[model samples]
Target: MNHPMVVGIDGSAHSSAAADWAAREAALRGVPLHLVHASPPLPGNAVPPPAADRLRHLGEQMLARTVADLGDRHPHLEMRGEQSDDSPATALLAAARTAGLLVVGTRGTGGFDALAVGSVALRMAMAAPCPVVLVPRQPAGAFGDGVPAARDVTQVVVGFDAHHPVSETADFAFSAAEARGAGLRVVMAWALPAESVSPRTPAVTEEDRATWEDQEVAQLSDALRAWREKYPRVTIRPDVVLLHPAEALLNASRGAQLLVVGRRTDPQAVDGRLGFVAHGVLHHARCPVAVVPHVD
Candidate 1:
């Protein structure tokens, strides 16, 4: 059996939007949908027993309601729910171990109102074993009314680094595009060498800039050759831009249904922080962002 698509729920509007997105995704993938709600333990005397009990009860009720609502919408899809005493990140990380895809809202209930991405969502994107999809809340009436707007024409945008290509990241993007029957937009950004830009150095002519851009285009095409064969059905659009990686990706995400980027997992790196490009895209990309972890 395929691993289920797991999503963290916390009775927040963002989480509700995430659940809706996950339900549609689970149905598309023909896999089970697992909902998790975390109610972390409080310090001694932080809350009275009765109050804690009430909180737990409310969490359970929220889980049941979400499950039931999704079931009603996706009657044929397999669904289940779990309430964990662990913190949100801990619970979701454990769930990700056995999940095909882990999903969560961009901002949950506990975070500051101004935060575009919540702490738990960021942590999961960096540390989860599987691909993490962070769904941002859509405009009012975008969901929960009826059918979502058709996304058939919307492409799946993925940031590609030809110099350090990660197969897992490309594979995930290709598969996602294939599943959605959408085109794949591969964005690669490049800049002029620092030395070439210095005043002491000879001015780089238009021909030189064109040659460098061509090289980047060629490298990007070469990197995507295998993925093209793997997912022939997905129309590929290679975009080599003269802009920052984050800016290029954010621009491509304007009408995209999903934006995919890589998070290099360094075993020795104790920080466990997302790479610069991924972090920036996650903060500003309007579309749902998928952070696929891979070893460089």
Candidate 2:
């Protein structure tokens, strides 16, 4: 079942931007927007007895204010607010089970520098049950203070691994593009064959390079064949790049509405949850980044 888009707000500039970003996305998806704020009760003896009430009260006010602001801006979009006592990550993760997409700030009240993507964002990106979008503190012109023309943001860039492409991720990208009448650019990064990269190997010939490129192109085509059939109306641009996957995606994301990447849902993994490529893009991508987890 489709679920409402959820955003976590903490009365910070980044989270405020996240709320606005979520409002726009909810409007695009034609779904409800749920505003959630987590103000975990302080440990005993840490503050005045009334501090918990004050914190919760503050969170409620923030939620109310956000709801009112977004309600005025997006008349057709449904909006509601709630406060959770769980940690930010815990609160959002539980909400994720019922959310189609979880939106969060690149940082929260804790991040001092503009470039710092906080721990909660990292945790949710790795463990959320649904797709998660990390809206940066400083967003693009379209996602900035003024609501620019949506048509100006024309593309959703998705990184695809031809050998083991994730269908859910591909579909997510297609759906996002379709929602905005934007194009989908599927990017694949490859390198030289093992034989060519080995020590003492002769320099690759033009014929071998041509063969490799053709093979990579074919792989990309085959990987996306079903998606193309499913989303015939969505314009698809398949990009096979020679750069590292993260760098290639970062470069492609310059003018995109969103960069979509996949996280492996491996139960046994202890750390490095988002993986190298995804983690890199999340840290560096210029546009909003979506981390869609898949059972790879």
The best candidate in terms of TM-score: 1
lDDT of 2 at 259: 89
lDDT tens digits by residue: candidate 1, 1-296: 17999999998998998999999999998999999999987989999999999999999999999999999999999999999999999999999989999999998998698899999999999889889999989821243346554443368889998988989889999988888888989999999978777767668989889999999999998988888888889999999999999999988777578899998888786436698899999988777999998886
Global fold similarity of model 1 (TM-score): 0.92
Q: Candidate 2 on 55-145: residue-level lDDT in tens?
A: 7887888789889999999999998898999989889988988999999999898855755579999999988888999988766534434
Ten residues in sequence with the least summed lDDT for candidate 1: 139-148
Against the true structure, what is each candidate's TM-score? 0.92, 0.92
